[model samples]
Target: PGGVGRQLLQKPTPAPAQHPPVRYPLTGEPRILFWAQNFSVVQGSKWVDLTSQTFGAEASVDVSGSSWSSNDSRLVLKYANVLGSPLTATFHMTSRWFPVSGRDWFQLNRLELATPSARPTVFNASQVTAPSNYSWHCAHLSSLPGFGAGLRGHGPSPSWGVLLQDVQVPAGTPGFSPGSGRGSGREGLGGVLAGACLDEPFPPP
Candidate 1:
């Protein structure tokens, strides 16, 4: 008599642990448009002037893309040699959410200057010499505003610098040369130099 073979029941392997998506500080090739009525950069012990001559003068920097979440409150930008130095300059953005306004307002909290010889030298907002009238904005390729409209605004300016995340210039716009990392020789009034585009990834904090 042939013995009946019993079916072996094997336990199913548990599904891989589901993890939340990772969030970065920035995403897409966004251009950071910034301007200030008056500002300065600390060079050694003294402060170097980097201001705009006119009230509405501005500069921009095109950055590479990163994977991020919409809930992130921090954005970091890294540019190599854009400051005419071998080290890379990192801009750290800090934001606060306003439920009443249903928007997030951010500011340039600090600037990090990377050095080949040692760790980055941290520069706070005050150290950057940004005057009380300093203003800033951010633009993305997917959500660029009309030409010259990104910086146009009405009413009194905010006390803190605002990073307009949804403003940008098209690839072939005048005065903006993609992939060149250089401006159209139109430096801001106070030597606020334009930054070159760099494909660097800066993760969110």
Candidate 2:
């Protein structure tokens, strides 16, 4: 029988021409979080251009964004070259939402890659949204210890591959669970994508 899934699918909300400003993180300056640009052009995916950079010549994705929106779609950066021995990668993501008035904010969700590794491997990126009264998403793709595994750290990871996929937020409704991930168990915790890595030999700014 059709349930909430049916309702959700009935009339998907149209993405705004420009997402609400409140979706951007209020805290922290915007900066590049992680990137890897050593791959050659392979093909194009539904959203991104595929690359031929494999491990030792590996593929990658550069995560970037200062804000988020529920209306936004999930992001996934991937790499695959199963020519020899078993190689693997995983992506874990978390999101946070801050309100406009109070000093209150909370965790929304955390997602981890179930399978350790496989060809066409993918990482799950994240985004968020807040109530009309709120100001920003207050999220960034920080180099938090567990985030992106050891690939990223306390600061920007120079050449690591990653993607943002989940888009959960604190909607203040029943069944809308928070405190789902490692850092999200605490208030005022979450991260956002800052920027993608460079692929072309373009000049630096």
Candidate 3:
């Protein structure tokens, strides 16, 4: 039989209303992660309405979570847009996760994580999980440089556009949506998404 082809057809684990928490380096903030292969929408608005902000899916998702340590982080502010003139429009965001006990937002979250220019990495339960207790499946997207993605790095890419399998949003925080696009990869070590560029705006449509 076609083992590889058959495996592809298999069903996915019904994600939990609350996906398990993952702790990124430095900041031990907790974020909910998932493995979304693809996502699309067929709302009423197309280009004219959206460009003028007339109406449609102007949604947002607040990602906040706590890790085993003190670190906490919030990321990816999403919204629906028609890719108007100004290419950049808070399409998505990434922020830093702090290392503390209480709660706080990260500083170096960066802008690419949420933007379409962002990378396509994978996150598998085998990679980010703790050595002691691993429960969820592993997922990876593009890779960022400097931080230390380590031995687990899957060498640059995958066969298709890697969806936002799962994120590390806080348990209670909600999230936003920017529709869809092809993501890029960060060529560094442990360079996860942080939220400085996440809130900025780019070109004009």
Candidate 4:
């Protein structure tokens, strides 16, 4: 009986070894996030010109028609990785068009950016930052037979421009490696044009 009790008391058979938790790597690639605010059109203004510039590339959109003003619209553009060494990525733009009427009008949706070689990137309204009052002017083309654009001409007063910010994805972000070609499962940025409410006074008062 004493021997049995001693065996029961012997150190409880030593607990299993505890190991440290594993840590995943983060993707340090540079990304640019930008959006527009205070976007409104005056009566008789048939079209507005929007431009986004970054990483030595520029994207311009001429927004026209009353339907665009009535509902939320999204625009996405994709370009070859400007940061890449050989510079072999192609350039393209994609626009997501939604219905102007009904429930779709109230919901804010995400935009996607895709490339031929990699997966798509998604951007949502939640990611947008506070608005800044950059002067965004409409361009007037003489061939179009309209008022002169504002940034260059004394045309209509300039409107607020888009806000641009640099952001980085956490380690282990998918589709970041050159030719990794795997989906990150997380939303990413792409060429898109969308209409949604922004933080008040995005262009600033």
Q: What is the C-alpha lDDT of each candidate?
A: 0.30, 0.27, 0.26, 0.23
The residue ranges of model 1 lying beyond 4 angstroms of the native Cα positions read: 1-31, 35-42, 45-62, 65-85, 126-205
Q: Model 3, 73-151: lDDT tens per residue? A: 3333233443322222111212333355333332222222123554432233222222111111212222323222211
TM-score, per-candidate, Cα-based: 0.32, 0.21, 0.19, 0.23
Order the candidates by lDDT, highest first. Answer: 1, 2, 3, 4
How close is each model in CA RMSD to the real structure?
21.9, 18.5, 19.8, 22.5
The model with the greatest lDDT is 1
Candidate 1 achieves a global lDDT of 0.30
lDDT string, candidate 4, 127-193, tens digits: 3222121111111111111322211212232221112211111111122221011232112212111
Count the clashes in each prediction. 5, 22, 73, 25
lDDT-wise, the better of 1 and 4 is 1
Query: Quick one: best TM-score, which candidate?
Result: 1
- lDDT of candidate 2 vs native? 0.27
Alpha-carbon error at 101 in model 1, in Å? 4.0
